[model samples]
Target: MIVIDPASAVPPFEQLRRQLIDDVSTGTLAPGTRLPTVRRLAEDLGLAPGTVARAYRELESAGIIETRGRNGTFVAPQGDAALREAQRAAASFVDQVRTLRIDPEQALALVHAALRSAPTAP
Candidate 1:
């Protein structure tokens, strides 16, 4: 999920691109996760498809994400061991969610609840 601020001086494409990169770093968007199509995201954000496409293109060029023909874009894998483990866990969780046919919003809510209650390491 991304938000576009029309009032900001930063271009729409840059905003989209940067937010996605940040999401990847924060594990909000894990590697191998499929992204919404440019056209679909553009429609949702009220921006031109070109704007979204440009952002995707830039991300692809920077190795932050990749696009496969007719398959859609995905966050590219990272070199960090912790991130890889996180990606694996996320993929497993997603598979379990799909297998159980859980509502995505409900699943996300559960994850938020778990994160909130989880104890942090000292």
Candidate 2:
């Protein structure tokens, strides 16, 4: 299940992407587990199908998930190292934000603003 924050600064796709990654890393979504179809997830999250598709595409690019034609998407095999590294980086960011006494909501807003200003990579 994914939550969409229309008021939050983060894009829906990024939110979905981050949550999926976090879930996989935390074992809330185990490896080899099948993921909901993009359309289904988008509908459930009240997001555009393209938004969910983009998140799925990025996750696949990160090697966190895989898709096999009609077989559907699944958590990739061999992503433990990648997931661990990502978790470490995320934890460090959280620690830094906490150390700076940044309000959680404000930090999330900043993330959304920064992401909006960031240039897209080729």
TM-score of each: 0.64, 0.67
lDDT of 1 at 98: 93
lDDT of 1 by residue, 93-118 (tens): 99999999999999999999999998
Instruction: Summarize candidate 2's per-residue lDDT along 14-99 as a digit string, tens digits.
Output: 88888887788788889899999999998898889999999999888778899999999999877673556567667888999999
Regions more than 4 Å wrong, model 2: 81-122
Q: Give the Cα lDDT of each candidate.
A: 0.84, 0.84
The C-alpha stretches of model 1 lying farther than 4 A from their native spots are: 80-122
Compute the lDDT of residue 70 as modeled in candidate 2.
100
Candidate 1: residue pairs that collide: none
For lDDT, the strongest prediction is: 2
Error of 1 at 13 (Å): 0.4
